[model samples]
Target: MALDKLIGLAMLAVASAVFTYYTIWVFVLPFVDESNILNSFFLPRDYAIKLPFLLLLIAGLGVGTFIGNVLIKKAEKEKLKKSKKSD
Candidate 1:
């Protein structure tokens, strides 16, 4: 259980870091230039994917993944408690 928690925390930290980087890059890319190298991220392309209203979708995905993992762990812990109680 301790190991699982540690791994989950580590993964969440990494994902958060990646999310921050992408968020900042996307925000600053346009200021750089219309044909700037950073423009290759195709962030604008994503805007028109007709998915969401903001460009934070990538970071949102990271957050969602982290939350899902955490919920799964919590459910596993609950199941363990139930099993022990049954015993």
Candidate 2:
């Protein structure tokens, strides 16, 4: 569908923009003068590394929680089935 294509394109564009900005902030900015006005546009250099690390940590936790929940539910369902068979 056209709508789906549009959404995908928009997401790709946004992702590309973020990647370019982050690359610049991390790799290029450090070499730039600290007193330059460009430095003010970005957060302190330390956060550029910390932010992505924090995001990855949170995403990992979320995935782990989701998998645990699904496994727990599946085990409960199997246990219930077994109990019903014995009844």
Candidate 3:
């Protein structure tokens, strides 16, 4: 649908903007003078590194939890099936 396409395009645009901002903050700002106005637009330099690492760590934990939950549910289902067969 046209609405879906519009939403997707909007999301893509936002993602692109964030990526460009992050890339500039990480790669370009470091070399810029401390007194420059650009520094005001972003967080401290350390966060550029720490933020991604923290995000990655959180993402890993989320994925691990999801996988574990799925495995637990699967084992429970199998156990139930075996018990039903034994009955």
1-87, model 1: which lDDT tens digit per residue? Answer: 699999999999999997776666656654786777767755564554354455477779889999999999999999999999999
Off by over 4 Å in 2: none
What does the lDDT read for residue 66 in candidate 1? 100
lDDT of 3 by residue, 1-87 (tens): 699999999999999999999999988998999999988999998888899999999999999999999999999999999999999
Model 3, position 78, has a per-residue lDDT of 100
Each prediction's total of clashing residue pairs, residues at least 3 apart in sequence or on different chains, is 0, 0, 0
Question: Per-residue lDDT of 1-87 in model 2, one digit per residue for the tens?
Answer: 699999999999999999999999989998999999999889898898799999999999999999999999999999999999999
Task: Please list the Cα RMSD from the true structure of every candidate, rounded to 1 decimal place.
Answer: 8.8, 1.4, 1.6
In candidate 2, where is summed lDDT lowest over 10 consecutive residues? 40-49
How much lDDT does candidate 1 score? 0.76
Q: Give the residue spans of candidate 3 off by over 4 A.
A: 1-3
TM-score of 2: 0.87
Query: Candidate 1: where are CA atoms >4 Å away?
Result: 1-55
